[model samples]
Target: MNNNLGLHETLELHELLLFKNTCLTKANTLSEVAQDQELKNILKADAKASQSEIQDIQKFLS
Candidate 1:
């Protein structure tokens, strides 16, 4: 996809991507030592979704 993003838009996209990356990392870290099975499951699911989101955003940015 052609980026065609203006400076402001590009910066906003970069910020959003960074935020998503941070959330994904947090989800992964939490899931690792999560004790409650249910909570762990939820975290894992969220992490999976976050990963997908990151991939999508990266695809768009690139």
Candidate 2:
């Protein structure tokens, strides 16, 4: 299987990385003010996963 990204694919990945970063930021910020314990835990988990995904995307880009 091919592992290289084409120009279009690279651009799309860049966009996805940006969107993920936004999601991570929102998840972190919302978790701070979340009233429900379950909701806060969910947001924290999302943020952690997002961070890992962001690192993977960055590695691919590099």
Candidate 3:
């Protein structure tokens, strides 16, 4: 589970992951509240993209 990442890289990646998860959560919430179909679609797309990003990160991890 360890790589050559220094402390700064590790912290930055951790922060990045947390931010991505937040984006996913916010997107899902906004998607529910979005009245316009177009806006809702965009929010759903954003959520999907965030999930894909998490999968990519998992690839880097495993």
Where does the lowest 10-residue lDDT sum fall in candidate 2?
1-10
Which stretches in model 3 have alpha-carbon errors above 4 Å? none
Q: What value does the lDDT take at residue 41 in candidate 1?
A: 93
The best candidate in terms of TM-score: 2
Predicted candidate 3 versus true structure: per-residue lDDT over 1-62, tens digit per residue? 43767777767777888899999999999999989999999999999999999877665554
Q: Worst ten-residue run, lDDT, model 3?
A: 53-62
Each model's lDDT comes to 0.86, 0.94, 0.85
User: Where does candidate 1 have its weakest 10-residue lDDT segment?
Assistant: 1-10
TM-score of every model?
A: 0.88, 0.90, 0.85
Order of the predicted models by lDDT, top scorer first:
2, 1, 3
Ordered list by TM-score, greatest first: 2, 1, 3
Compared with the true structure, the alpha-carbon lDDT of candidate 3 equals 0.85
> lDDT: which is higher, 1 or 3?
1
Sequence-dependent TM-score of model 1: 0.88
Cα lDDT tens digits, model 2, 1-62, are: 11687888888989999999999999999999999999999999999999999998888888
List pairs with backbone clashes in candidate 2: none
